[model samples]
Target: MFKQLFETGIGVIAIAMLSWILIWMTRQARFLKAEITDSIKNALGEDNRADWGIFSLIFIAVFWEGLETALFIVAKFQEGWTPVLGAIAGLGVAVIIGMLLFKWSIRINLNQFFQVMGVFLLLIVSGLVISVLRHLDAAAIAFSHISSSTDLCGIGKNSCILRPQIWDFSASLADRQFLGILLKTIFGYTQKLYLIQAVGYLLFWTIVGSLYFRSLSQSTQLKPANKFN
Candidate 1:
């Protein structure tokens, strides 16, 4: 009972923080979009000292992203310190890439970079849905036991209404194995996947994929018209 409350409280707070950041970003999307576009084109060539506002905007944007990431990391601490290590490694790579881009005048297609990162983030969000469901299932089961009711489990002692394992691939690829761990971290692979978890993942991808493809189709349709002009 207490464990469930603890987990729920922490998870809720972390999600709320991240969601607030997301909403704030969305609300400031127009200004941020223009600012970032101009900043990238200038590539720090402009005298930031002259325009203190631009520097403040850049600092605030970076700080918000960093704060959101920190909250997300806390939310995912159940995945262990591997994710923290990965974040550190990724930060190093990002710093190196930024240096190379600025100092070396390396050409990078920002559109492609954002598209790839968007897809990666979508996958992570889907995985988080599964994680949330898994946690909810545990809490529900715990509550059922305390209340002396089998409502959460449904049919049997081992059977859970929300988290009944749909399939187990542990025989073929153990989740503890290196490959399994890699997939789990990257793509949220599970040896014992639950029904609700699968549903949530599939539903998320389905909706997101439809919207993404539709946007791509619209962009493709508009490109020729722009070129003709």
Candidate 2:
């Protein structure tokens, strides 16, 4: 329980970090709604208004991320109070961290912040591959175990991808239980992993994140040392 809670909590924080980082890095927000938050501040003037605006945008975005998790819980489990409580707790932790950064006079470079957070995001992304693999593994186990067919012998075969089920827990990497479910929804997790799932996840990050970052590189402008995002 504790393990799932801890992993889930970290996962939520990582998601929050990734959200703000995306807000910072992308020059033109791909989504219309997200554009208003980041670029609006850039148009405001970096002195005081822009600074406050950036913070507000980040704050609102983080809130939205938390709210999304809360709503997801409500949608998944109609009367579940635990997910709501878990969402609040997870959001609270992220808020505290933000408060510390805002309150402290310590200054951090925007690019460096993204770089660090980006690395952390990558790590979590890798874990997602592991999670997907587990899901595929579950499918393989259930199909192979039940069926007498010898053709579906390979990992993540057609018999598995079409029907997924939990296969094992002794080596499960994901969190399970109430808090764990909250955490998983807030972050991203599956207790088990499979070969094909891991490869697909890797392709996603390698292709998508690279393209996103590449676009940012093309769009970036020369700015003062601390001003780069």
Candidate 3:
């Protein structure tokens, strides 16, 4: 009960909050006073002795993401270090990436990063649908297990894993169903995958990942040009 709220609630609130903030930022942009704009511009201008525009961007992004995650932890967990820890870990990764970006001035391969993260999110979505089915089955008073022998299993190698037994979350300390729910919310997963979802996931990952990595590979091979008047 508590676990579900902490896990799922965090996600819902964070997304909503982010959306709200973006809308507010857009609306407030025109109202920003020229004095304020000039001050910020001075701080961010490329001519500044301390190049802060990049840092400012990274700081705001990480801060808001961290802040939202923290609120989620408090609201859903009712009070716990889990969300804080999660935010910290995420921040750590971002910091490492930021340092690299600053030290090397080379543009990061965002395409590849998006492809990797996209594939991971897709798998989570696929898993979530299947997990929800299991949750419903568990809540059922007289659930009957179906046989893999059903036509859905497929005639040959493509056959589904025969009436897949819903995952038993009991083995782990926290009920896996509950944990799976948490993962589905946080990481995303599906227990019983539909034929189409599986194919689509595979196709998207293959196409996107391939293209992104190919771009990276090509970029790496490009020779450095001498910049002179």
TM-scores of the models, in the given order?
Answer: 0.60, 0.42, 0.39
Rate residue 120 of model 3 by lDDT. Answer: 60
Give me the candidate number with maximum TM-score. 1
lDDT (Cα, tens digit) per residue for candidate 2, span 1-229: 3344455456446545664566355544334434666677567765666767668989999899878877777785665876577666877998787887798755666555665676566556655545544444455555566677654656545335523433434254436675556445544555543455556556756765776567556544423333423
CA lDDT of 62 in candidate 3?
83
Candidate 3 stretches with Cα past 4 Å from truth are: 1-70, 73-78, 138-229
How does model 1 fare in lDDT? 0.66
Clashes of each: 0, 5, 13
Q: Model 2 reaches what TM-score against the true structure?
A: 0.42
Per-residue error at 140 for model 2, in Å?
13
Better of 1 and 2 by TM-score: 1
Ordered from best to worst lDDT, the candidate numbers read 1, 2, 3
Candidate 3 per-residue lDDT, tens place, 33-65, comes to 446767767776646654566587789998998
Best by lDDT: 1
